[model samples]
Target: MSENGGRRSQAQRDAITVEIGYALFSGAFAAAVVFGAFAGPALLFELPGGLETLLLRTGLVVAPVLFVARVVSVLLRFRQSPQPSQPGRTSPDS
Candidate 1:
């Protein structure tokens, strides 16, 4: 028994799992990079209180946004591609 009531094969499940893992990993990496870019100066240098607060807040907002964007983009792109989960769908590009 599986999540899909055993409707899909083990291979299909495995593929989906891998794709999800990839999406999460990429999202986390992108978020970390964006956060670092935004907060790096604030963290590294001794700046005015207002400026530091602004930079930190901006990083907090932007990082999450980028994370969601990356995850959704990857998953959506993956869904558009050919998959064994949906055997009949050969994808529009093909």
Candidate 2:
């Protein structure tokens, strides 16, 4: 029984670690995409006209602000959410 419990605990820890790893990877990927979308045109193509330069500059400024706002909103929603109760844990109010 003790060995089984230990195994379960270890599995839970491993799962949590995997989840955190995925979250980090996803965040990195999102950041890279955001950066690439805004910067790729400027770096990869020669701007033949002023309009293209203006558009790229505008996107570079606006995209990061929008992305940061979205991230903050999601974090706020997570913070406001109630956590699930563990199986053996009792609420203090109970």
Candidate 3:
């Protein structure tokens, strides 16, 4: 393959990786929200005993915190990424 072709392929792979990362993050956040919303109320009202209570309470606290951290990390990484050049414009680095 030609040099430019290789670069284009690499760029496509990178783009796909970023997209998958975003999708996974979105799924994680959604799961966290669903679990927290459903379980929080149930735990508050029903009051499970022993290990079940500990597990549910731990999940209630951990899931949202982890989701927020994942979001922040993704945002920071996204901000740090360079913008793609327009079709007609030469990249500044080139």
Candidate 4:
């Protein structure tokens, strides 16, 4: 155990921050892509107003669900991964 007891080191905190940013960026990107895919035909073609509205509405609902799922999956994977050895640490095999 370290002197800080259960507290994470600065490097650990930095890793978490980076992971969080990565998750958010990727989630937003996924959401945008999903929305574009769903509503692109409506936007590009001359669809009826009702159909266009339906497509847009479906996209609006689906995008956020994807965003949340993306974020959760990424963060969960990051959390489950093994942490790297700290600086100046030696493995037992060494």
Query: If ranked by lDDT, best first, what sequence of candidates would result?
Result: 4, 1, 3, 2
Q: Give the Å error, residue 49, model 1.
A: 1.2
Candidate 4 lDDT (Cα, 0 to 1):
0.92
User: All candidates' lDDT scores?
Assistant: 0.88, 0.64, 0.68, 0.92
For model 4, the run of ten residues with the poorest summed lDDT: 82-91
Better of 3 and 4 by TM-score: 4
Q: Looking at model 1, how many pairs of residues clash?
A: 0
RMSD of each: 4.7, 7.8, 9.6, 3.4
- The residue-by-residue lDDT of candidate 3 on 1-94, one tens digit each, is 3367545576657875786689567859775875776567666675557655766777777777667776677767766776575757878888
Off by over 4 Å in 4: 1-3, 86-94
Q: Compared with the true structure, what per-residue lDDT tens digits does model 1 show for residues 1-94?
A: 4576768777867877999999999999999998999899999999999999999999999999998999999999987876555576666766
Superposed Cα deviation of residue 29, candidate 3 (Å): 3.4
Clash pairs (backbone) in predicted model 3: none
Clashes by residue pair, model 2: none
Order of quality (TM-score): 4, 1, 2, 3
